[model samples]
Target: MKNQFFAAALIGLTAAFGAHTANAQEPQRFETEAHAIEVTTFASGLESPWGLAFLPDGAMLVTERPGRVRLVSPDGTLSEPLEGAPQTESFGQGGMLDIALDPDFADNSRVFITYAHVEGDVAGTAVWRATLQRDGTPRLVDGTQIFRMNKLSGRAQHFGSRIVFAPDKTLWFTIGDRGQGERAQDATDHAGSVLRIDRDGNAPADNPFIGTPADDLIWSIGHRNPQGAAFNPWREELWTVAHGARGGDEINIPKAGLNYGWPVISYGRHYSGGKIGEGTEKPGMEQPIYYWDPSIAPSGMEFYTGDAFPQWQGNVFVGALKFQLLVRLTLDGDKIVSEERMLEDLGERIRAVKQGPDGHLYLLTDDPDGRVLKVSPAS
Candidate 1:
């Protein structure tokens, strides 16, 4: 039965792979030449802000790791915590995660959020979407539990919850392996995968593996714990950064139905100092475009197309949680020529990176006393 299921999945993957071949091409990787990167402390005395979203009025919505959401004004003043944030477990890496306004938020005022929920000492990841009210309160009138993890092992590690809306208006969400590596290979589980769904939380009919009598929300599998996710503006390809076991932190462009080769094939080792999988080179598994050897513990990612830095128009920006810095990856076609680190002096774990409405870079610090900082040219 296992063999039959695997064969059927492979067939679906191959067909989807062929359809995406024309859209697939190598990306430009540029050498990272040193430039003057000035970091400024925008706001202080915050409490572990994790997610960031911009409002049409030029203000911003920021999510706190301790289960609170706030509205930050353009003048850098923070509002009182918005009321009605869903209760979160908030232990370990679990808390309020990513936030994104609906594609038509200006008209609908719809908002989406991810968090870790606990029930009877068991914690799991969940995604919900609702509306933010005008009176500094979240109405949450249309709350929908769009997605949830399969198993609830009470593990506080690897709840990779990040959401990005594609240009096509489809939602692409990342799920962590949740410290159970073997479940990544399980077709019935949502862990360690990228799932694509419609605004209504329904699977698309044209999905690669849809109508195969299996859950069609899954777009790709074999990921460990991916926190950073974004769509490349130039090529419209989805890109992600995931934490590896020891080393081998990866930056991969996920292909539909392709196996990313997690514990089965990794450049990292077991936490207990054991071997992992059959090594890096395998026939069917996809490899990362750029991987870190010593591990950077990447969190959120964004592609720069703003006019603030003309030279960095196409550069990729990633937040480093463990390294406490921002990694700037320069692309020269399909290779990462160089990586530049910024904000090293601040000594804070960056949890998110985003492009503001005016085209400047905005960041959220992931510390207990976290703050939302803005990055721009040193004037």
Candidate 2:
């Protein structure tokens, strides 16, 4: 009998090797400047899988945007949607979003998730913490809503909400302007900012904006709509990829109390082919380490610090939704020196990119039949 749960995984991976019955495409390999890489479907039949995280044991946790979480065993058995996920609404880019395990998940059994919490017509970005129970039945319990945006909006767009744990153990999350451009410049508004808070949702004492007239959780202001965030352990700084209006997708290393010139300055034109924000450079705003013109609609980002491909170490990876490809950025210390676009023929809107513990690159596709793809070095 054909295995109903999963196909055979490669590289000793314990995660999905593509859904047994749903995947049929042959794996493909592409040559790059540093190394030849192979892309294979690790799992399929996922509905808009937005976020992916690997557990210590190599099992994977995946979140579907329409509001569900599931466990994918290495052998390809998929768990039922875990209960106790926060209630959310899905419309115009709002739904259950990123997922991250507690830094000490092995000891705490805690997990964090970001979603669009709905209240009437108002929907806001929210973070919910829960204890993941996998004994007998897989489910979430002891749920706690650790954080929610201070001001909810009726609009369903621009919920920038990728979460990462800083080296200091505090949580950092992104929020967009909720389609209100000027809102990003407001220090008091959570929208259009990078926020840092304790795991319990309290602002840390040393948060840069604490004594200022900004919200306690606000770390930096003037972001457009950041969808991808990762902490570069090598530099001990937070890096983010944010969507631009028409042509100005940006990659910024947001700093404490600094403004990132969104509505004030941008490299791309407005959707109407008009000028944007003082023509890209201003006196007080920070410039992006790099940016994309004619916007590729970048989403998830990963800093390659894995051992599988030693040459790829110190590189950066980003998934592009608009162009349906993966981007590898060659960085020289803090500066991005070159960019190579790959996997354009994969034919999926790559939503998120994750570096697994084993140092392989994994991705989530954005579609009704979304999938988890694993990228490894090609021999």
Candidate 3:
């Protein structure tokens, strides 16, 4: 009887402590069109956090644009910047950008990262793959560069680097125009294109430009600065969101052997208010399935397929930097039917969005004191 009373007392003490902590970090709640929700900071103290990935054990891998990678725990604890991340340049639109776990991560512990690095006087996007060591001391081992842009320049902007793994085990990634619009139309250049390669950086045999003068890795070309990308599980297709000059931010289903029409054609005008290309349509170039006038400056994207909010299933979410809001588009089979803007009062530049393994939505705010905000159904 005495042992039972002691156990009950310990349980009560633990519960009280938990309740106090929860109250201290009280969640901010908001009502959306579909569901009322609560947003809580999941992790903090990150510097300009740009990328977020979930580990099998529920920890998170977040990469800061200032060239640091941190491991965050479920309970909001952050590990010191993991050692052995690839060297990076934090120039304009450059830095350690996106990260992804190998498809066979459970067995091999391999991982990949995209960063902006300089070679000679020119800077460009590069990919690094390594073995992630987590045996008490978290660090990367056997690090190597799997890919680098062959065509680089003095320009520092537009290092379009987002990594996505396809269903067939191949890796697909994007590179931007590096502030030069003409490069997007150059088939010989790797810039302004979606590229496909094996985990070891070898171009796949089935790549569209095998025997062509165009780079063997090129899958699609003529993109401006496609920063947001994902493999749509429901559609088995790859989609990307790219920045336009002034008014033509767009969403394109980047396909093999296709040209997306960047400098050659656009729905937007130049920043100086001049007309862009030959106008919004061209015969051979593809058009965007959806576009935004005046540009929301989208960075990260995700397709919600979770049960946390059943109402949000089949919806597409994009993080907007220009307006500091989360943009949700309801789709009727790839055709965006409507747009709903949320979190205007949060006053944070949402950088990346990830659907957590727990069926909740997570966002990385881009700031010196960045935070991982967890969004859940209020009810």
Candidate 4:
């Protein structure tokens, strides 16, 4: 009877994933140019793990897209789902997303999370902060809503939610156009912009658009669907990876009060091979630092400043969801020197990439049976 049940489950899985069965198997040996590395499965059986954050004690917190948070130990032990997580909408591309720990997490156990929030018939992206109590059964305490997208749409695509903290401890996050392309050009709308706010969700007094048509929280405008964000310590700028319609995947450094040129100017064309907006460049809008003619569907990104891989120092790493690989970009002062693709044989959607406290590279795969993987120098 057990064998029969197992056989039935296999059939169900095959039916569900028909053409994508290649992504369900164990990861294969990865190839790299700079150094020999080993990919170890740190933890397994996570359901579509979307975000990863490391605690000072070496433990990690992972967010599952279906509205669950799990604590993972250094020794590969997965704990029970934490309680007190905010309710998520969990629709098409919506659910529990990025997880980030406060810079002073050692003093305060505060953690921040982004998720799809729904109220009645309308839905949008929302961020929340809470204190994580790790005594026995891990749970959240004093959860507070920090920010919410100004425009709510009924559609369920393009919630570009990625969070990063600046040196001043101010929080920055991205929001997609919510599938409404024209709204990205509107400064007053929060649909497609990078927002900067204080820990208490207040706009800083130094904001460029304060008292103007643009919302005071907005730092940059004209974005599509940015999924990857990181603070480059070397350049001291906020970098982002955003998705385009058909081709035009871009890497941008969002600056205050600047327009990024979305629908009005795009390197990518429509999915139907039609023109997007104007041409790729205009007089006032900014061009991307680098763009991909064929989209890779980029996700989480991080700059490598750790000592584990000296050669990789100062390089930027990004995860590719559609291409199912990890991208290493060597940069010469923001000009991309070269690009290398790694872990192409992993056959899974690389949802997030992060550097562990131990200086190792960590990754979360997006799958029904997702996994947390650690990359180290192979002995």
Candidate 5:
């Protein structure tokens, strides 16, 4: 009788625990779309490709993680790596990251980049804007260091480093927690937060914590190590893919002034199976729209709004570093109805997914000798 009573008690406790943690996880779905198209490799022998931006005149700009930016022509030819790219620490995960073109690139020739800098024991990330010359050289004429974080500690982890411009012309940038466990919720700290700023790198007056003592550039707080960010095609919402500790990679729809419930609530524990954050539920915290258990280590993301694949229009394409695959999420009006995995046989870690100006899909392979690949119908 005593044993039965103890078993009942344990079951009840487990049920209560699962109740709080259930919604925080997405069941693993392993279906991949059959490759109706052949995957063609464009250029190889390039260094670790982090990001790619296409130019209006048919050239391409690619950023290497080791602090070089190269111009590639439409025929997969590489131009000489640009000079005057910002010097990066190039430590373990610390180096150059995302690259983006100004929305008014035709008129302004303005380009932006994010990178990790090490100054003594302190290492943090910064964003800068420069101008591209007519002959495809990048001369950083107005190199402005826009935003930075505290508590870098030179740990060589979690730089975040993805930048995207919203429809409203505001630039949103992600900053990782820099391996600091408790700093995600620190209002005064820029670590683990997504910030919205004007083109001049100043915080907007309407920012949530603008007048407060906290960092004024903050848009949404509580991120782990976000590496993927893109604007949604349907709603134009800002969508991000963040890495979790052991499991629990998350896809978040970030909004201003919201607390994203990092460190406070996670479905994953530490790699050693210890506790993470406070608990799963706290009042007034925002929950993720979707998350992954047994994490895929999501990297770059793009919304499939192109006309090439009519069936995939409006779906979300995310790159996986750990799994070395491509993940596609089929959303039924913002609710993830199903998920699929692709490119398992390719043995390449996907770094970025982009829609070319020709409405075809382009991807960057994340490798020491990465390649630019194009996906089209096999026929």
Candidate 6:
């Protein structure tokens, strides 16, 4: 009788702390309109995998949040952790983040990565570039720190990192608000801005703020914590997805020298239900193309131009962390015509989305025992 009573009490305590429980529900399948797709586990045993990049030879490079990068062969074999990755500040929301192959990777095996780093007592996001040599033992050579966030903060959250190459061959990357709202309005700071730089981390001569108080590297300002960035090849525009405090999650096309209006004009309220900034609109600020009122917590995104799904051509796919699903946004030019929630049955936090070289969509689930899932037409 005594043991039964104690077990009952323990179960009650666990139920009371339900908010702290990790959602580890198993993956499930669902049907789509234009195609019947099957979601298959491509690779498993990844410790919180955050990013995925494909090499020219169909191999893949995946970033694990606990500061490791692993190579995945086409046959689903994961290599031992690669060497020469930087020592990252891995805690809370910080760690090894996004990875991208250099545009000329066929000629130059250059690769880029973003991660949170600590110097002394301060921590911030930093971008690095290195040559990946596959001869004998695969390793990174000539690693260089390309860009580091300007204002270091003790806060570990909101390291908005995603990397994409522009049509002009320059690199565009994001830096979040660092949990400090007012910093987004400061031009002198690199936090809360989308920055553009050359392959060697040099500020482009044609940057809009060359002579202003703003940093020369800043391309656009007033972002909260933008995690998703991609270039539309057809439109030649840069699109970003950002997180809001409580409700408003947004998608914006970051133009040169534009202000995105985060705290100063947010559709989201504080977590405590208090109003943020000036209540959602300002004359000089640019509005998002679309927004979510309840906050989906979007992360990685990509525009689909693959041949696997003909009906999905030109649509935008974004990963949803809070909702544990994938969002497919239909686009009619610059406007978002409709949104379809997908893969909800997976019941896992979808962290990143990338269209593979084989014209199928791949996703990374965020969990200690995370996995890489591939979506293809159902057989």
User: How many clashes (backbone atoms < 3 Å, residues ≥3 apart in a chain or on different chains) does model 4 have?
Assistant: 0
Model 5 TM-score relative to the real fold = 0.88
Q: Write the per-residue lDDT of candidate 1 for residues 13-88, one digit (tens) a residue.
A: 1111000011222322222254444455555556777888899878888887667677777766666666567777
Residues 1-379, candidate 4: write the lDDT tens digits: 1233223222112112111111233434555889888787888878788999998888899998877888887777777677888888456677899999998888899999999887765678899999999887788989989898887877677888899999989899999898999999999998889899988899999887998977999999899999999999988999999999898999999988999999899999999999999989999999999998899999999999999999999999999999999999999997898999998887879999999998999999988788888888876
lDDT, residue 79, model 2: 78
After superposition of all CA atoms, the RMSD between model 5 and the true structure is 13.1
Cα error, residue 354 of model 4, in Å, equals 0.1
Candidate 4, residue 68: lDDT: 83
lDDT of 3 by residue, 36-77 (tens): 999998887777788888999888898988777888877877
Q: What CA root-mean-square deviation does each model show from the true structure?
A: 11.9, 7.3, 11.3, 6.3, 13.1, 7.5
Q: What's the lDDT for all of these models?
A: 0.77, 0.86, 0.86, 0.86, 0.78, 0.86
> Which scores better on lDDT, 4 or 5?
4
Q: Please, what are the lDDT tens digits per residue for candidate 2 over residues 1-379?
A: 1222112311121233233333666779988888888988887778788998898888888998777788887754567778888887566678889999998898998999999887765778999999999898788999989999999987768998899998788999999999998999999999999999989999999988888777889999999999999999799999999999888899999988899998999988889999986788999999998999889999999998889999888998999999999999998888999999999988889999999887889999998777888898986
Name the candidate, 1 or 3, with the larger TM-score value. Answer: 3
Better of 4 and 5 by TM-score: 4
Off by over 4 Å in 6: 1-28
lDDT of 3: 0.86
